[model samples]
Target: MWVLVFFDLPTETAKERKIYALFRKNILKDGFNMFQFSIYMRHCASRENAEVHIKRVKKILPEKGHVGIMCITDKQFGMMEIFHGHKTVSANAPIQQLEMF
Candidate 1:
């Protein structure tokens, strides 16, 4: 499965900007990759693992913004088509994990 987080927070005020940066840093520290501006993605082995990140996000969410999270299976994620202007960008990167025995 894959977890995708999308957020758009207020950045006009200094405090709001700080919160925005904190949210980004927190997710990055939590292993989410920047899929796009305000969008982050991570791969998980199961729905339970995805819920872990979701709960973390809930903890760090700010008060004045919209945050959306969704989880999709590997097959569903693979079927996603990405494009930039007139070109296509591949979205089939294999999920890499470090499993400790």
Candidate 2:
């Protein structure tokens, strides 16, 4: 399974330090990796293993901070794609309205 984790923190001098400490401890013990700052992507052999890892991380996160996690299997991860579609409608209104007869 593959997992994506996001973390939001409060504004403080030691916020990053605290978050990193917890992350390092959990990752090292559970075999996770740092894909990005405040974001982590991981793979596990079984669903039980994945759940255990997430549970441990959740326990260490600061109560004041926000944490979001998204998990998918390896097969599903490969089939997922992000689409960026152009807007067909404009935000601003038409400048002229009375010229046509």
Candidate 3:
């Protein structure tokens, strides 16, 4: 599964910009990669694992602006079609994690 985070935070004032930067830093520290300017994503082993990351993101949400979290299966994610202008581009392969028992 993939955990995707979308956010649009206020950046009008210096304080608001600081908050936005911190929010982005926090999610990156949580293992999310920048899928786009305001979109971040992380690959998870399972729904439970995705939920844990989602909770962590929730805890650090800024007081202002909007944030959204979504989960998609590997199959669903793979079906996504990406393009760079007129050319089609392949999506980045998911990172493999070793599960220690």
Candidate 4:
């Protein structure tokens, strides 16, 4: 499973920018990688794990701005097509997750 976070936060003021920075930092600390500006994604070992990260993101949501959270199966994520300008590009390989039972 994958947990994808999409956000659009206000940054017109210094304080707003700080909030934006903190939000980004928090998500990064939670293992999300930069997919694009305002978009972060993390691969989870299972749906339950993805829910945990989703909850964390919800807990730290900014008081002002739009945020979206999505969960996609590995197969669905693999179907994504990425391109740069006129050329096609491959999506980044999902990070290998180690599970200990």
Candidate 5:
């Protein structure tokens, strides 16, 4: 499972800008990786774990621009197509197994 967060918060005033920074920091602190500007992704061990992170995001949500939270199966997340210009990068592949030392 994956918890994907997409947000656009107001930054018109100093206070609003502070809020925006705090929100971004909160998400990062909560273990989300930067997927793109204003977008983040966190891989969870299970659906229940994803729900926990989702609730944390909601707690720090701003009362301004739109903030979206979504959960997708690992298969769906693996289908993402990332490209830069004509070059393309494959989505993250799941580990087949972990070798013991």
Candidate 6:
């Protein structure tokens, strides 16, 4: 099981600080690896372990902010695909990716 965890605050001001603090306190406890900014993807030995982590995250998260967790199976960890204005671009083609002009 792959879990994608995201954290969002109500405002930009102080959001990074608060989120980072929460991340340090909660997510780091179980030694899970982060997948992206404000997102953590981890493989657990069992569902109980995942649930415990999620509960801990919920406990530490800010009351006013939004936190989301999604579980997906068999998804590549670093699969890259470019999208232009909601359109998917082939990875093999010479189309300019979003990172370049």
- Top candidate when judged by lDDT against the true structure: 3
Error of 3 at 55 (Å): 0.4
TM-score of each: 0.91, 0.62, 0.96, 0.94, 0.89, 0.57
For model 1, the superposed segments whose C-alpha errors exceed 4 Å read 98-101
Worst window of 10 by summed lDDT in candidate 1: 90-99
**Clash pairs of candidate 4?**
none
RMSD of each: 1.5, 17.5, 0.8, 1.1, 3.0, 10.7
For model 3, where is the 10-residue window of minimal lDDT?
91-100
> How many pairs of residues in model 6 come into backbone collision?
0
Best by TM-score: 3
Give lDDT: candidate 3, residue 10.
98
Q: Which of the predicted structures, 2 or 5, would earn the higher lDDT when compared with the native?
A: 5
Question: What does the lDDT come to for candidate 3?
Answer: 0.95
TM-score of candidate 4 against the unseen true structure:
0.94
What ranges in model 3 sit over 4 Å off?
none
Prediction 2 TM-score vs. true: 0.62
Q: List the residue pairs that clash in candidate 1.
A: none
Q: Worst ten-residue run, lDDT, model 6?
A: 91-100
Summarize candidate 4's per-residue lDDT along 7-89 as a digit string, tens digits.
Answer: 99999999999999999999999999999999999999998989899999999999999999999988898999998998999
The CA lDDT of each predicted structure is 0.91, 0.67, 0.95, 0.94, 0.89, 0.61
Decide which is better by lDDT, 2 or 6: 2
When 1 and 5 are scored with lDDT, the better candidate is 1
Candidate 5 per-residue C-alpha lDDT over 1-101 given as tens digits, one digit per residue, 9 for 90 to 100: 88999998889999999999999999999999899999999988789888999999999888888999989988998888899888998987643534589
lDDT of 4: 0.94
Ranked candidates, highest TM-score first: 3, 4, 1, 5, 2, 6
Tens digits of per-residue lDDT, candidate 2, 1-101, equal 77677877665768766766766667656755665577666776678867887887777767676889888877676665534376343222112324456
